[model samples]
Structures are given as C-alpha cells and as structure tokens.
Target: MKLRQLASECDEGPCPTVWTIDEDAEHVLVQGFKVEDEEALATMKMPEHETTVRTPMALLKRVAREHLT
Candidate 1:
C-alpha cells in the first residue's frame, strides 16, 4: 500500500507525523514515540500484534484541519 503524508510536527528529523493509507481517506497511520508507560498500558486490552504510540494533540489537530477537511 502507498502512503500519503498528511501532517508532520517537524520539518526535519524524527517527529510525530500522520499518513493516509493507499487510497483510503477514512483511515490513517500515525508515527510517534512508543508508549512505554506501564500504568497506561494496563488499562488497555492491546493484542501482541498491535502496539501504540504517544503524540501531542496538536499533531492530530493539524491533520484534521489541513487534510481531513
């Protein structure tokens, strides 16, 4: 599947970012820091195949304003 970048928090280097998958506009892929908080992890029923990341809300808001609309 192809990825179309929707938003990025930084101009260079590793940072929180968002992308659209193949031609599906309804769903998106996010890249951010890995979630390593033990207390937070215990609240979720995450599967072994799935993992989560941590990012600022501004990253999501930027994508929603600039790309989702």
Candidate 2:
C-alpha cells in the first residue's frame, strides 16, 4: 500500500514504523527519531524486531468484537 494511505489509517500522532498490506510479514516498520540532544530530534530508524510486536488494527477489531459481548 502507499505511504499516504497507510499514514491515514493511523491514529493522530507520530507516524508508525512499518505499514504493510500484509500484517503477517516478517517485520512491521515504524518511522521515528532519536534525540541525540535534549533539544534536537534527529531522524532515526527503528526496526520492528527491536521493539514489541503490536496487533494490527484489523486483528484488534476482530478480537474486540469477539469479546465485547
């Protein structure tokens, strides 16, 4: 999927690391910055493997529905 479309689906905040049409892919990428100095935010890379894996929105909705009742 296109970056803009992926971006649109996200909640209002910083951009996500990885946007994928297939959530089951090997990795879920996210875009972020590293604060080398308190006053400076430099663009940095955050690999999916480096952090906790998150449930995709589609999956979350399904799970919510299953237990909501």
Task: State residue 2's C-alpha deviation in candidate 2, in Å.
Answer: 40
Clashing pairs in 2: 16-30, 17-29, 17-30, 17-31, 18-29, 18-30
Q: For model 2, how does the per-residue alpha-carbon lDDT over 1-69 read when each residue is reduced to its tens digit?
A: 433223322567654334443644443344444334422222335444543333346544543455344
The alpha-carbon lDDT assigned to residue 59 of candidate 2 equals 44
Query: Relative to the unseen true structure, what is the C-alpha lDDT of residue 46 in candidate 1, on a scale of 0 to 100?
Result: 75
Clashing pairs in model 1, backbone N/Cα/C closer than 3 A: none
lDDT of 1 by residue, 17-54 (tens): 99899878678899999998877787886778989999
Q: Please name the candidate that would achieve the greatest TM-score relative to the true structure.
A: 1
What lDDT does each candidate get?
A: 0.87, 0.41
Judge candidate 2 against the unseen true structure and give its global Cα lDDT, from 0 to 1: 0.41
Q: Estimate each model's TM-score.
A: 0.86, 0.24
| TM accuracy, model 2 | 0.24
lDDT of 2 at 46: 49
Please report how far candidate 1 places residue 59 from its true position, in Å: 0.9
